[model samples]
Target: MPSPLPSRASAAGPVPGRYDRFLILGAVCLAGLVLPLSFTAPPVAIPAIAAELGGSPVALNWMTNAFMLAFGSCLMAAGTLADTYGRKRVFSIGIVAYAIVSLLLALAPSLAVLNGLRIAQGVAAALALAGGNAALSQEFHGPARIRAFSLLGTAFGLGLAFGPSLAGWLVQTQGWRSVFLSSLAIALLATVFGVPRMRESRDPDAAGLDWRGSLSSTAMLALLTIGVLEAPERGWSDGWVIAALIGSAALLALFVRVETRAARPMLDLSLLKYPRFVGAQLLPIGTGFCYLALIIVLPVRLIGIHGLSALNAGLMMIALSAPMLVVPFLAAVLSHRIAAGTLCAAALLLAAAGLVWLGVEAAAGSVHGLIAPMLLIGAGSAVPWGLMDGLAISVVPKERAGMAAGVFGASRVSGEGIALAITAAALAGLLQLRLSSAIGVDGATLTQAAQRLATGDAARAQALLPQLDAAALVHSYDAAFAWLMYGLAGLTAAIAGVVFALLGDASAHEPAALAEPARDDRIELADEPAC
Candidate 1:
């Protein structure tokens, strides 16, 4: 297993003598970069978008989660379609759809319309991500694949790092609408390059479709997401919340049954048997829950609570995002020399420690206190983000590349949305508990107050609950934050241990021999235990 090290390659690690892989990598990276832009940029513009479009607090939450939930729900189905049809075809279609949606975003007359389009954008995003990652995993081999994934990580990091800063500038210069246009420009650009440059690839043996599996998977994700998002507004005991939860469970069972019986399941259930692959998936879920939660929440905290302008609020995050931009390149360099598990575990430990520190200071509403913690968390997170992705995709053979990438992407995006929802719900419940004791507000009023605080709408919170002492409100916010940060920190730290213990050896994940398309007709791929 060690003899065919990634450093020693099948023709210098796939795409042997040609630079065509670089072009493909660039196209994919371009698409990957746009996602963080869409995610982070909107947070800065939310207040503006809400004001112009006249949305309720719930509408605002949907503005963000709608995209994520739709994307997450459709990812597996999109992967199957990619495998059955063609990666390039799907990728190009996604780019075009994304561009069209982004353009429509600027023209939407109401938040409801914008939210609907965002869901469409999410679907397009799923297609692009599945196709892009599958293409990279299939074409790049050995160290080159590692480098390719790392580069993709770097692109993602760059998007995360710069998105807020750019959005703040754009929102200040142009209208809030410019943020959508900015994203549109990128998508249109990706389409131009992707159409001609991308190589078409598909699984020749793929069955048509798993209709029941796809339908059930979508219902499961959508219902679970709906339940979590509503938990903050309506009590967990609310009839609809309870029904959504039950329906989600039932649908998940049905999805499992269908997948197990299908000739070609949307996802390979057998992949779950590998501890390393599951562990790799946990990376995205934990990261989505923790780091991204921080990104989404912190800017709002800085802007609304600390009285910083959006520009300054974003600038403060430079400590976090800046490290992310450079860390992936370093990770790519060290991948050959270090064990992936050891490196990722060690880095996450650093991140967890940082999160704990950040939580304590963040609760007190101190922007200055967050800088060091942000740097620590950023450094820890960037190293492993791409590596974990490589781990997930590497464990599956090229034929199932779309499925593997879809799984990885789903974990990350769904985890982010779910984690944020949970964090917001927990914060709201705790904040209300604290406030009820201190301020004596009724349950319904407190629910609204908590929702406002969760969304970083300090202005709306003050306007609604003017009788509450300002000092008491801040204290309650901090108290809720304290619980969230510490819990997430401990959880993240624990997962670090799992990484070391679970991902024992990655040589087992080496790619099966891939036939050079131009040179050989011989192709050998196993359907199971590729890891």
Candidate 2:
């Protein structure tokens, strides 16, 4: 009664017709790259884009956050939909939509339109990514699956690491619009290549989609992200900010309640019952914080403070990303010998060391001092990025792999969104403090000015603006970096603790089992009820 095993030709194994399997994998991975490429494009062209668009600094922040908010919040829903529909079908649709949205983005004449298109792009990306692991798992079994998964991880890392570089090249050669054009082309190609060969995977008897859970979770995430992203511009105590936080908490509570009661929950709440699952989820949260903070803050510090060109800053960032390129393969190899927890711990230590070194060195104005540390951070980050997917999936039943994968992806993205918000708040607070000190403005004066500005007292900010000096601005920036160092140090310590306590030593555990005994032809694609 174990649903009659799939036919040998369809089952995941070393079959003669497996060439098509590789093609499917390649198509999915290529589709996966589109989102990262889109997300990273603006950072490379922020200065130019802002100059042409005539937007304030905050607009730059929204450019990325808007996409992340939509993408992260909808991930679970996309996965659920994939499970209800067919993986191949959903993936093809997503690729087509993403391609169309990319074209729209390329033609957008205003920032608002571009951001709107980005949100649509995020939704499309969610759909494309939701079924990725399920499809990979179905195509390759045991050792083959491990390799494919490792490659999937590598693709993700490469997307982030290479996106800016690619964007930079496009911006330099054909202008900012070229980035979107390139993305559209890739998406189109993915659709063309994917639709023909990709096999469908859907559980015919899968539980109904949990619409209530999905809606509540989405509401919670959106409200929370909005609140956090807005706190820097609006004081923490602002009514709208407070309302968002309150609403987020209420919605999250509702989501938890609904999921607990739902027969078919969007998120499988029971997964957290396993210690390994909890650890796997938390590690990515920490990793997200480390990864995004470094990605966002490092370039700003380099270009804004060190007076480096965007190209030079980008190259320097490579030091932080290069190890990532190699880590996935290494982690895949190491997984055969070591416990993932142990490797994750070691990676965290390396990341912490790098962060600390970077913070101290940057505060001291020594770019050279940051290089070695960044190398360590890059190496450390590689371990988690490579292994976390395996760990997340391993903790769950094979039948729930699709849901587990969705949770893993959603958690990482959510962590990134939260990290950006927190880092932004920290940066804004640091800037304000530095600005106040440098300008010799008392807290009372600044508060009064800010209050007036909040009430449409543009004249007050205008009056205060003339008194701000260049040296003071520089001093403020210096102070902001100084404060940010404290945050970096704290994060390093937290990551180190989590890795050491939860992960332990790599040599302590046996490798996960690889091959299942079914014959090659008996392999059928895994059922993805919640892609």
The candidate scoring highest on TM-score is 1
Which RMSD values do the candidates have, in order?
Answer: 5.2, 5.6
User: What C-alpha lDDT do the candidate models reach, one value each?
Assistant: 0.76, 0.69
**lDDT top scorer:** 1
Off by over 4 Å in 1: 1-18, 50-57, 109-112, 363-365, 436-451, 457-468, 507-509, 512-531
Q: What is the lDDT of residue 252 in candidate 1?
A: 90
* lDDT by residue (tens digit), candidate 1, 104-169: 998999888999999999898888888788867766777878878887877876787788788888
Residue-wise C-alpha lDDT for candidate 2, range 1-531, written one tens digit per residue: 022233433433233257777777787778767777777776777776777776777777677878877887777777777666666667777788889988988888878887788889888888888766655555566556656666776677778878988988988889888888999998887777655676666544457678898788878878887887677567688899999999999998999999999877777777565456667777776666666577777776676655678788888888988887778788878766776677777777677667776767756667667778888878888887777766666554444455666777777787766776677666766665655665666675665543333223335443665586544444555556656756765775686577556545422122222223341222235333222
User: TM per model?
Assistant: 0.87, 0.84
Task: Note the residue pairs that clash in candidate 2.
Answer: 8-521, 8-522, 10-523, 10-524, 11-523, 11-524, 12-523, 83-529, 83-531
Candidate 2 lands at a TM-score of 0.84
